[model samples]
Target: MADIQRLSLNQATVQNWSVKEAVDGCVRHGIPSIALWRHKIHEAGLQQSAQHVRDAGLHVSSVCRGGMFVAPSAAERKERIMDNFRAVEEAKELNADSLVMVVGASTEVPIADARQMVADGLAELVPYAREQGVKIGLEPLHPMYAGDRSVLNTIDQSLAMAAPYAADEVGLILDVFHIWWDPTVFEQIQRAAGRIFGFHACDWLVPLPDTLLGRGVMGDGVIDNHALRLAVDAAGYNGPIEVEIFNQALWDTPGDDVLNKVVERFTALV
Candidate 1:
């Protein structure tokens, strides 16, 4: 294992783990950080879950999501914004390093328009998040998901839109699974600089099936995760290395075992 700090688990990677189990899993593996989805804390309730993590002496890297900003009705948009407010509150509750935002896309609207909707939602949430002392980490899903998952689809593109809301309060998550093939990835890492709040790792399989679940385990696919982590480190990011693989095979296993393997691989790779 590398002496440098390594291996944080994003809750989705071990979705089968309860919030309690996940905290202990990380503690047992000697991982220093973690990121979580709202669903987990909501299931466990914020206070109890947050206490367990703190008691275990672990760092909460970021909360998994916010920013489903595209909607047909004003009411729906308001609801999404409120949900983000609650997510930021959860970040506060857990003392997370940041709150991860997945700015959603609307196929019915033009990509540009959808992105603007995201900007609007962030404008509304960023101030409150800043007040609560939670940094917003925007994750740019790959261009393949621009139609359904996120309008902010590239590192440079996401940073361009997200930079305005960013103070000490908000930043970006650079994920190799999402952006490894991006032509500008090298430069954008430099551009993101101090603003890169988190780093996620996984591999992209060649014959990608289902467009979503084809995420390969760390060494199983073609991605250069080592190079990606090095780029993140070079960009002046000395924070958590979050493992965020959304693969079907791993999901079928017990979450504890999955986490153990992830720590094992992350130690060897990064």
Candidate 2:
């Protein structure tokens, strides 16, 4: 059986839940950790949100995002970076393990240019993250999100981008839903080794009707969660396993019921 303590609920899994409710849900369900999102954190008030998580005796696995360097101009890029700095600060205040970065989507600029922007932006933030004693998790979102969500779309690319910094300063977010289709996933997991910041669990459906909201619960779709779990474990990642599905159906369901199903699936399939 998967150790319940190692399993974490990403707030997006139950999108409708208030921050307080999510934290309390975790506490009630014996979930010892969570990966939080920015909107929900702001909605609950930062200090209060932090206190609530602390009061619940929950560990924050990571802060949901701190990237999006692909902008139309220098000024826009600067604004994005500034916003990311605040995200880093929030992560630190929450005592999160890492500040997750979604990087950026491809804009009018060439894809190469957008990628360089990501690298350049990180060059600036990595120092600050390290200074604040927080790791920057470079999450390579799926290729499908390349146009509007993320330009970094593979583990190898994410690792290469993070190569300039030490593992403690820059790491990778390995979401099974995103990278499961990559042919070299297993090899890259081994390559990631100590640099794996967090491992996210979700399933990708075939003929995905709604790309953004089509994520299936663990074992309900095609992913072999057990195999992927073993791979991450063998790669020496002993951190929280975060469930980060973005399904409208799941979100519409009652929060407690969604969490219970998540725990059940995690126990049986992950």
Strongest candidate by TM-score: 2
Per-residue alpha-carbon lDDT of candidate 1 for residues 198-268, written as tens digits (9 for 90 to 100): 99888888888558877877887889889888888888988888888887778899877887778777877
Taking all chains together, the TM-score of candidate 1 against the true structure is 0.95
Q: For candidate 2, write residues 142-188 as lDDT tens digits.
A: 99999999999999899999999998899999999999998989999
Q: Estimate each model's TM-score.
A: 0.95, 0.98
What are the clashing pairs of model 2? none
TM-score, prediction 2: 0.98
lDDT of 2: 0.92
Candidate 2 error regions (>4 Å): none
Q: Pick the candidate with the highest lDDT.
A: 2
